[model samples]
Target: MKLAWLRSLESAHQDCVWACTWVPATDRSGGLLLTGSLDETVKLWNPEDLSVVRTNTGHCLGVVSVAAHPSGRIAASASMDSFIRVFDVESNNTIATLEAPPSEVWQMQFDPRGTTLAVAGGSSASVKLWDTAEWKLVSTLSIPRPEGAKPSDKGSSKKFVLSVAWSPSGRQLACGSMDGSISVFDVQRAKFLHHLEGHTMPVRSLAYSPLDPRVLVSGSDDECIHMYDAEGKTLFSSMSGHSSWVLSVDVSPDGAAIASGSSDRTVRLWDPKMRAAVQTMTNHTDQVWGVKFEAVGGGARGSLLASVSDDKSISLYNYS
Candidate 1:
């Protein structure tokens, strides 16, 4: 697979852009890109030309994560203030405002079937699930503390969850934490299955291969990306090239390549088979915050990848 720089929008937001997701196409509109920033606003863009479609405001603090429902009709954005806003993608109408206090929200994702939304609960050391139909809190998958740690032990906070991802089949969920361990859980049983350990620093991002449910990829503050057998609980390989923290990582829809954004100010595309970076794009002058592949749909739009950075810019690329 190869990536060709397509376009970029400078100053897309007033501050650092931290999160982005693809809003699938609907009958009334084609697929659009949604991005959130430290500026406290979420903006929708027409990828065809990287033009602004709409800007959503009212987020209290820097937006930490953004997720799109499978139906393409709605999307959710979460901020550092611990609030989640679920709204209509087209009309921008508010659907629901969700929060689980004392459980700060970090990353969020909707299940493949769109029945539930899973959020990474920081400090609480758990993953919170919300029923989409009623927008009600359904379950909390708390991480098990270490054997010698007490419930009130200060070291337990080291497991503060930072990112969450769902397996393609939606049967399993994985959450990454500040201490670098990843907790895998069985969604149907709502039980913790196992923990995958390798990185020594905070794991800031996680993504499961869309084509392989067992293959999971993670980026960490240690400046490396590790691929794991999600179901088998084994480390497949580790790739290191970034000079600074790897902020975000995403597997291509075709699963042929993995893309990562790093604080080193570059976006690197990796060949998972070779376990090495094949190319790096260095257009952004600051830390890269997020990278995402467009989830395929019935529309004829070609394969696309997007990256946002602390430089207040969004870059688009054609992936083939």
Candidate 2:
């Protein structure tokens, strides 16, 4: 398994490209690349040619996260000011605008079944779930504070949530916090389960294996990637190689590998069985904020990987 350079688009966005995700193919269209940037625009690109399909604006204070629904017809983007714009992919028409005051939004994701949108609620120490049909706030999955720790304790507020991931089953959700701990929750029950602990810095990314429901991968500011058993609440492996903060992470379609982007300006592929980094691509000149695998892959293309950076560029690679 290795990554072959395919193509790169320099200055893909005017400012930092903070997030990227592959929109799955639908009956009416092929898969497309969705990206959010610090320039306050969310753009869709033709993955085949890296051409702009559409440039979506209306966000303020920089767009930081973008998520595609399982249906491929809808996408939601969140900006630094905590505003979420949910819109149709083809028409670019606004579907809904969501906001939760007193709780800033960081990362957002749609569940595999397309029923709800889960958002990382920054500073609120919770993950908010929204019903897709009604476009209404449904639940807030809050992290349980340590016993005897008062709400007045300064350290308690640092549990600001930064990232979240839904398991393959969608029955469970995992959220990463600035205080360096991962909290897993039972979605149906809206209950906090346990914390996966190891990294001592903020965890900026989280991914669940598509094949194994129990496996969860995380990247943190501590410059390490850790894989955990979400069900068992145990750290399975910790791989360290990046020289700076690991900003983003994703598991491949086959679940055989994990890919990560870092402040070190590199993207790395890790083998879970060996607990080691198998390959590293130093293709970006600045911090790499996002690395995503094409959700579904086959044919001659095999699997496609995309890395977006603070350099305002996007790089594509063929994973085989």
Candidate 3:
């Protein structure tokens, strides 16, 4: 696997860009890029030329996560203040503003079928699933505190969830926490399945292989990327290379490689089979917060990867 630098947008936002995702192709336009930043805004970009399409404003605090609906008609952005705003992709109109009182929101994603939205409930120690059609809270998958742990203990406090993901089949949901534990859940039964443990620091990001429902990859503040069997509850491998924390990670569309962004200010592409980084790109001078691969393929762009950094820039890459 190789990554060729396509283009870089300097000062893409006034502040750090923390989250990014791809809006799939629609009848009106091809696939476009969506990004959220510390400047309290979400921006849309044209992938072909790496040009700005539009800027969305009104978020109070730094936007922590952004997720696009599968149909490319709607998108959601969540900020540190715990508000989730869902808007129309084309008209940029407000569709819904969602919030769960006392439960801060972090990374969020729409299910594959776009029926439910899964959000990481930061202090609530749970994953909140909201129904899209009605925009109402459907259920909460709470992560039980460990045995012999008190409700006011540090162990419960460290369960601050930071990221969340869904399997390819949409039957399983996995969430990563500040305590370095990953909890997998059965979506159908709304039951907490088990926990996958290895890292001792915060797990900032997670992504499941598009081709395999059982395979899961995570990036942590421990400066390592771990591969896990979601069903078997085994950490099969851990790869480390970055000098600092691994902030973000994504699997390639074909499931051949993994791309990671680190606080050390570098983007590394790893060959999962070889269990090593094949290439490293060090163009950003500040911590890289997000790395994302386009979900679908076709149109003018084939396979694309995008990265955002605290240096206030956005970089696009060609992955093959």
Q: Among these predicted structures, which one has the highest lDDT?
A: 1
Model 1, position 295, has a per-residue lDDT of 65
Q: Residue 149: error of model 1 in Å?
A: 6.9
TM-score of each: 0.96, 0.97, 0.96
lDDT of each: 0.92, 0.92, 0.92
lDDT of 1 by residue, 94-200 (tens): 99999767439999999999999999999988899999999999999998764444667644668899999999999999999998889999999999999888988
- Candidate 3 regions off by >4 Å? 146-155, 296-302
Clashing pairs in 2: none
lDDT accuracy of residue 116 in candidate 3: 96
Candidate 2, residues 169-202: lDDT per residue as tens digits?
A: 9999999999888999999999888888888899
lDDT of 3 by residue, 1-320 (tens): 79999999999999999999999889998889999999999999998787888899968888989999999999999998679999999988999999765448889999999999999999888899999999999999998765455667654669898899999989999999988889999998999988899988999999999999899999999999999999999999899999999999999998999999999999999999889999999989899999999855553444899999999999999887
The TM-score obtained by model 1 is 0.96
lDDT for residue 222 in candidate 3, whole number 0-100: 99
The predictions' CA RMSDs to the true structure, in order, are 1.8, 1.5, 1.7
* Candidate 2 error regions (>4 Å): 146-155
Which parts of model 1 are misplaced by more than 4 Å? 146-155, 297-302
